[model samples]
Target: MRVVTFCDIDESVIDSKHTIENFQSGCSGEAQIAILDINSIFDFEENKHEACADKFTTIAIVEDDSDYDAFKNFGIDAWIKADDFSDINELINLIEKRLFS
Candidate 1:
Protein backbone atom coordinates (compact mmCIF):
# COMPACT_ATOMS: atom_id res chain seq x y z
CA MET A 1 0.00 0.00 0.00
CA ARG A 2 1.07 3.54 -0.72
CA VAL A 3 -0.01 6.26 1.70
CA VAL A 4 0.46 9.88 0.76
CA THR A 5 -0.23 12.62 3.22
CA PHE A 6 -1.03 16.20 2.21
CA CYS A 7 -0.78 18.89 4.87
CA ASP A 8 0.26 22.49 5.51
CA ILE A 9 3.91 23.53 5.46
CA ASP A 10 4.67 23.35 9.15
CA GLU A 11 2.66 20.22 9.74
CA SER A 12 3.95 18.81 6.52
CA VAL A 13 7.53 18.70 7.74
CA ILE A 14 7.02 17.67 11.34
CA ASP A 15 3.87 15.60 11.30
CA SER A 16 4.75 13.86 8.09
CA LYS A 17 8.11 12.70 9.39
CA HIS A 18 6.50 11.43 12.53
CA THR A 19 3.78 9.64 10.61
CA ILE A 20 6.31 8.10 8.25
CA GLU A 21 8.39 6.74 11.07
CA ASN A 22 5.36 5.34 12.84
CA PHE A 23 3.91 3.84 9.72
CA GLN A 24 7.20 2.26 8.81
CA SER A 25 7.45 0.48 12.13
CA GLY A 26 3.82 0.01 12.99
CA CYS A 27 1.70 -0.61 9.91
CA SER A 28 0.66 -4.27 10.07
CA GLY A 29 1.56 -5.29 6.52
CA GLU A 30 3.65 -4.12 3.60
CA ALA A 31 3.10 -0.45 2.92
CA GLN A 32 5.02 2.57 1.70
CA ILE A 33 4.18 6.06 2.91
CA ALA A 34 5.11 9.45 1.56
CA ILE A 35 4.25 12.99 2.56
CA LEU A 36 3.80 16.18 0.62
CA ASP A 37 2.90 19.72 1.58
CA ILE A 38 -0.02 21.44 -0.05
CA ASN A 39 2.15 24.53 -0.47
CA SER A 40 4.62 22.50 -2.49
CA ILE A 41 1.91 21.91 -5.05
CA PHE A 42 -0.08 25.16 -4.95
CA ASP A 43 0.91 28.78 -4.89
CA PHE A 44 -1.45 31.45 -3.61
CA GLU A 45 -2.28 32.46 -7.17
CA GLU A 46 -3.09 28.91 -8.12
CA ASN A 47 -5.27 27.25 -5.49
CA LYS A 48 -5.23 23.90 -7.33
CA HIS A 49 -2.97 21.98 -9.64
CA GLU A 50 -3.13 18.67 -11.47
CA ALA A 51 0.36 17.50 -10.61
CA CYS A 52 -0.42 17.21 -6.93
CA ALA A 53 -3.89 15.92 -7.64
CA ASP A 54 -2.64 13.15 -9.87
CA LYS A 55 0.27 12.06 -7.69
CA PHE A 56 -1.26 11.47 -4.29
CA THR A 57 -3.73 9.53 -2.27
CA THR A 58 -4.36 12.78 -0.46
CA ILE A 59 -5.26 12.67 3.22
CA ALA A 60 -6.17 16.06 4.57
CA ILE A 61 -5.58 16.69 8.25
CA VAL A 62 -8.42 19.06 8.84
CA GLU A 63 -9.12 21.01 12.01
CA ASP A 64 -12.28 22.74 10.90
CA ASP A 65 -14.71 22.99 8.02
CA SER A 66 -12.74 25.59 6.10
CA ASP A 67 -10.67 23.40 3.75
CA TYR A 68 -13.15 20.60 3.31
CA ASP A 69 -14.27 21.64 -0.14
CA ALA A 70 -10.75 22.22 -1.35
CA PHE A 71 -9.62 18.76 -0.27
CA LYS A 72 -12.73 17.14 -1.64
CA ASN A 73 -12.28 19.01 -4.89
CA PHE A 74 -8.75 17.64 -4.98
CA GLY A 75 -10.21 14.11 -4.58
CA ILE A 76 -8.86 13.18 -1.15
CA ASP A 77 -9.36 9.65 0.14
CA ALA A 78 -10.04 10.73 3.72
CA TRP A 79 -9.99 13.63 6.16
CA ILE A 80 -8.55 12.92 9.59
CA LYS A 81 -9.44 15.47 12.25
CA ALA A 82 -6.31 16.37 14.19
CA ASP A 83 -7.81 17.41 17.50
CA ASP A 84 -10.32 14.60 17.59
CA PHE A 85 -7.71 11.88 17.27
CA SER A 86 -5.51 10.86 20.19
CA ASP A 87 -2.28 10.09 18.38
CA ILE A 88 -0.58 8.78 15.28
CA ASN A 89 -1.60 5.22 16.10
CA GLU A 90 -5.24 6.12 15.81
CA LEU A 91 -4.52 7.96 12.65
CA ILE A 92 -2.80 4.90 11.23
CA ASN A 93 -5.78 2.76 12.17
CA LEU A 94 -8.10 5.13 10.37
CA ILE A 95 -5.95 5.04 7.28
CA GLU A 96 -5.71 1.25 7.36
CA LYS A 97 -9.45 0.87 7.69
CA ARG A 98 -10.10 3.22 4.84
CA LEU A 99 -7.61 1.59 2.52
CA PHE A 100 -8.01 -2.07 3.43
CA SER A 101 -11.54 -2.43 4.74
Candidate 2:
Protein backbone atom coordinates (compact mmCIF):
# COMPACT_ATOMS: atom_id res chain seq x y z
CA MET A 1 0.00 0.00 0.00
CA ARG A 2 1.09 3.57 -0.58
CA VAL A 3 0.73 6.41 1.90
CA VAL A 4 0.97 10.14 1.35
CA THR A 5 1.60 12.78 3.99
CA PHE A 6 0.01 16.11 3.24
CA CYS A 7 2.33 18.18 5.39
CA ASP A 8 5.94 18.14 6.49
CA ILE A 9 6.10 15.35 9.07
CA ASP A 10 8.60 13.14 10.82
CA GLU A 11 9.27 10.50 8.18
CA SER A 12 10.13 7.82 10.71
CA VAL A 13 6.55 7.50 11.87
CA ILE A 14 5.81 5.22 8.95
CA ASP A 15 7.16 1.74 8.55
CA SER A 16 9.54 0.91 5.71
CA LYS A 17 7.37 -1.82 4.24
CA HIS A 18 4.95 0.62 2.70
CA THR A 19 5.87 3.19 0.10
CA ILE A 20 5.56 6.75 1.43
CA GLU A 21 5.32 10.05 -0.38
CA ASN A 22 5.11 13.69 0.64
CA PHE A 23 2.66 16.06 -0.90
CA GLN A 24 3.96 19.15 -2.67
CA SER A 25 2.50 22.00 -4.60
CA GLY A 26 1.11 20.85 -7.93
CA CYS A 27 1.85 17.23 -7.12
CA SER A 28 -0.38 14.52 -8.48
CA GLY A 29 -0.64 10.89 -7.54
CA GLU A 30 -2.69 8.18 -5.92
CA ALA A 31 -2.44 6.92 -2.38
CA GLN A 32 -4.20 4.25 -0.40
CA ILE A 33 -3.90 6.52 2.62
CA ALA A 34 -3.33 10.21 3.32
CA ILE A 35 -2.08 11.46 6.70
CA LEU A 36 -2.50 15.02 7.85
CA ASP A 37 -1.10 16.87 10.81
CA ILE A 38 -3.83 18.91 12.40
CA ASN A 39 -1.51 21.70 13.46
CA SER A 40 -0.59 22.21 9.85
CA ILE A 41 -3.74 21.60 7.89
CA PHE A 42 -6.67 22.06 10.24
CA ASP A 43 -7.56 25.39 8.70
CA PHE A 44 -6.67 24.56 5.14
CA GLU A 45 -8.91 25.35 2.23
CA GLU A 46 -12.49 24.46 2.87
CA ASN A 47 -13.44 21.04 1.48
CA LYS A 48 -9.79 20.07 1.09
CA HIS A 49 -10.15 17.20 3.52
CA GLU A 50 -13.40 16.21 1.93
CA ALA A 51 -11.72 15.95 -1.43
CA CYS A 52 -8.99 13.81 0.10
CA ALA A 53 -11.55 11.56 1.72
CA ASP A 54 -12.99 10.79 -1.69
CA LYS A 55 -9.63 9.62 -3.04
CA PHE A 56 -7.81 8.12 -0.06
CA THR A 57 -8.27 6.73 3.41
CA THR A 58 -7.57 9.83 5.50
CA ILE A 59 -5.96 10.00 8.96
CA ALA A 60 -5.43 13.02 11.13
CA ILE A 61 -2.84 13.69 13.80
CA VAL A 62 -4.10 15.83 16.62
CA GLU A 63 -2.58 17.81 19.48
CA ASP A 64 -4.44 16.10 22.29
CA ASP A 65 -7.78 14.82 23.50
CA SER A 66 -9.60 18.01 22.64
CA ASP A 67 -8.29 17.90 19.14
CA TYR A 68 -9.54 14.40 18.66
CA ASP A 69 -13.12 15.43 19.31
CA ALA A 70 -12.81 18.67 17.41
CA PHE A 71 -11.75 16.94 14.22
CA LYS A 72 -13.85 13.83 14.60
CA ASN A 73 -16.58 14.86 12.22
CA PHE A 74 -14.40 16.20 9.45
CA GLY A 75 -14.59 13.19 7.13
CA ILE A 76 -11.39 11.52 8.20
CA ASP A 77 -11.09 7.77 8.51
CA ALA A 78 -9.05 7.80 11.71
CA TRP A 79 -6.96 9.87 14.13
CA ILE A 80 -3.72 9.63 16.10
CA LYS A 81 -3.26 11.54 19.31
CA ALA A 82 -0.10 13.58 19.77
CA ASP A 83 1.41 11.26 22.34
CA ASP A 84 1.26 8.40 19.88
CA PHE A 85 2.82 10.18 16.96
CA SER A 86 6.35 8.94 17.31
CA ASP A 87 5.56 5.36 18.07
CA ILE A 88 5.81 3.60 14.74
CA ASN A 89 4.21 0.49 16.10
CA GLU A 90 1.16 2.41 17.18
CA LEU A 91 1.03 4.30 13.94
CA ILE A 92 1.27 1.10 11.96
CA ASN A 93 -1.43 -0.59 13.98
CA LEU A 94 -3.80 2.35 13.72
CA ILE A 95 -3.22 2.75 10.02
CA GLU A 96 -3.68 -0.94 9.41
CA LYS A 97 -6.97 -1.04 11.25
CA ARG A 98 -8.28 2.03 9.48
CA LEU A 99 -7.14 0.95 6.05
CA PHE A 100 -7.93 -2.78 6.22
CA SER A 101 -10.76 -3.06 8.70
Candidate 3:
Protein backbone atom coordinates (compact mmCIF):
# COMPACT_ATOMS: atom_id res chain seq x y z
CA MET A 1 0.00 0.00 0.00
CA ARG A 2 1.07 3.61 -0.47
CA VAL A 3 2.07 5.40 2.72
CA VAL A 4 2.53 9.14 2.72
CA THR A 5 4.05 11.12 5.57
CA PHE A 6 3.57 14.83 6.26
CA CYS A 7 5.65 15.03 9.41
CA ASP A 8 9.19 14.30 10.60
CA ILE A 9 9.17 10.58 9.81
CA ASP A 10 12.14 9.29 7.82
CA GLU A 11 11.16 7.21 4.78
CA SER A 12 14.46 5.41 4.21
CA VAL A 13 13.66 2.51 6.51
CA ILE A 14 10.61 1.37 4.58
CA ASP A 15 11.67 2.58 1.15
CA SER A 16 12.10 -0.96 -0.12
CA LYS A 17 9.31 -2.52 1.90
CA HIS A 18 6.44 -0.13 1.24
CA THR A 19 5.56 2.90 -0.82
CA ILE A 20 6.74 5.55 1.60
CA GLU A 21 6.49 9.04 0.23
CA ASN A 22 7.22 12.38 1.81
CA PHE A 23 4.95 15.35 1.23
CA GLN A 24 5.35 19.01 2.09
CA SER A 25 1.60 19.67 2.02
CA GLY A 26 -1.66 17.85 2.54
CA CYS A 27 -2.73 14.68 0.83
CA SER A 28 -4.60 15.06 -2.45
CA GLY A 29 -4.94 11.83 -4.40
CA GLU A 30 -5.41 8.25 -3.24
CA ALA A 31 -3.74 7.96 0.16
CA GLN A 32 -3.51 4.64 1.94
CA ILE A 33 -1.76 5.93 5.06
CA ALA A 34 -1.16 9.52 6.11
CA ILE A 35 1.10 10.43 9.03
CA LEU A 36 0.30 13.95 10.12
CA ASP A 37 1.07 16.18 13.05
CA ILE A 38 -1.24 18.54 14.95
CA ASN A 39 -0.15 21.48 12.83
CA SER A 40 -1.16 19.71 9.65
CA ILE A 41 -4.64 19.16 11.02
CA PHE A 42 -5.16 22.77 12.01
CA ASP A 43 -3.39 24.07 8.94
CA PHE A 44 -5.76 22.17 6.70
CA GLU A 45 -8.80 22.28 8.92
CA GLU A 46 -11.04 23.75 6.25
CA ASN A 47 -10.54 20.84 3.84
CA LYS A 48 -9.53 18.03 6.14
CA HIS A 49 -12.65 16.02 5.51
CA GLU A 50 -12.74 16.57 1.79
CA ALA A 51 -9.12 15.51 1.47
CA CYS A 52 -9.39 12.39 3.59
CA ALA A 53 -13.03 11.45 3.48
CA ASP A 54 -12.41 8.26 1.61
CA LYS A 55 -10.86 4.91 2.58
CA PHE A 56 -7.53 6.56 3.47
CA THR A 57 -6.59 6.44 7.14
CA THR A 58 -5.04 9.43 8.91
CA ILE A 59 -2.63 8.74 11.76
CA ALA A 60 -1.77 11.69 13.93
CA ILE A 61 1.46 11.93 15.88
CA VAL A 62 0.71 13.92 18.99
CA GLU A 63 2.70 15.29 21.92
CA ASP A 64 -0.14 15.28 24.41
CA ASP A 65 -3.19 13.16 25.19
CA SER A 66 -5.51 16.17 25.01
CA ASP A 67 -4.76 16.49 21.32
CA TYR A 68 -6.58 13.25 20.77
CA ASP A 69 -9.94 14.90 21.35
CA ALA A 70 -9.30 17.53 18.72
CA PHE A 71 -8.03 14.99 16.21
CA LYS A 72 -11.01 12.75 16.86
CA ASN A 73 -13.25 15.63 15.94
CA PHE A 74 -11.60 15.66 12.54
CA GLY A 75 -12.22 11.89 12.01
CA ILE A 76 -8.74 10.57 12.77
CA ASP A 77 -8.60 6.80 12.45
CA ALA A 78 -5.59 6.18 14.72
CA TRP A 79 -3.01 8.09 16.75
CA ILE A 80 0.51 7.66 18.06
CA LYS A 81 1.73 9.37 21.19
CA ALA A 82 4.89 11.17 20.02
CA ASP A 83 7.13 10.04 22.87
CA ASP A 84 5.88 6.48 22.80
CA PHE A 85 7.54 5.25 19.67
CA SER A 86 11.12 4.10 20.20
CA ASP A 87 11.97 3.53 16.58
CA ILE A 88 10.74 3.55 13.00
CA ASN A 89 9.80 -0.12 12.90
CA GLU A 90 7.55 0.19 15.91
CA LEU A 91 5.77 3.09 14.34
CA ILE A 92 5.43 1.32 11.03
CA ASN A 93 3.99 -1.74 12.74
CA LEU A 94 1.28 0.34 14.33
CA ILE A 95 0.56 2.00 11.02
CA GLU A 96 0.14 -1.34 9.37
CA LYS A 97 -2.23 -2.50 12.07
CA ARG A 98 -4.33 0.62 11.78
CA LEU A 99 -4.48 0.27 8.03
CA PHE A 100 -5.97 -3.22 8.14
CA SER A 101 -8.13 -2.83 11.22
lDDT per model vs. reference: 0.42, 0.64, 0.65
Give the per-residue lDDT of model 1 (tens digit) for 25-52. Answer: 3332222333333433243114223222
- For each candidate, give its TM-score against the true structure: 0.43, 0.66, 0.65
Q: List ranges where model 1 is wrong by over 4 Å.
A: 1-56, 97-101
Q: What is the lDDT of residue 44 in candidate 1?
A: 17
Winner of 2 and 3 under TM-score:
2
Model 2, 13-43: lDDT tens digits are 6777777776654223556677777664554
lDDT of 3 by residue, 40-77 (tens): 77644554444443667777888898888778888777
Which residue pairs in candidate 1 collide?
none
TM-score of 3: 0.65
Worst 10 residues of 2 by lDDT: 44-53
Measured with C-alpha atoms, the lDDT of residue 99 in candidate 1 is 53
